[model samples]
Target: MNPQHTRAFAKAAGRFSNTDRIDAVMLARFGALMTPQIRPIRSDIIRFANWSPPDER
Candidate 1:
């Protein structure tokens, strides 16, 4: 995993509630399991283009 992803996971893990600590653990586990396939964001323009205006059908 990249340092940015690892750091984000650490920050998220730190925010878990006491009763929901297991959910945080699960998030960490899933982050590791899924990180290998994660791709960098490509183009913001393409994303913006694909978004519809509020009045559009």
Candidate 2:
């Protein structure tokens, strides 16, 4: 799904305010329900550096 459309849907669903915390929650919900494809990192170092649970991040 397009980011624009996702934002629009979130707005319609009463996410009127945009903030880092709120965006993270919204994206987490979206990812859980939508299960978007995750592209693998080309390098193990890069992946390891970036890897963390959402809560940890």
Q: Which segments of model 2 are wrong by more than 4 Å?
A: 39-57
**TM-score: model 1 vs. ground truth:** 0.30
Across residues 1-57, which tens digit of lDDT does each residue of candidate 2 receive?
Answer: 468756876787698457988887777777777787777666977989889878864
lDDT of model 1 at position 3: 52
* Model 1 C-alpha lDDT per residue in residues 17-40, reported as the tens digit of each score: 444676557567857666567567
Candidate 1: residue 56 Cα off by (Å):
72
Off by over 4 Å in 1: 15-35, 38-57
CA lDDT, candidate 2, residue 56: 60
- RMSD for each model, in Å, please? 9.3, 9.3
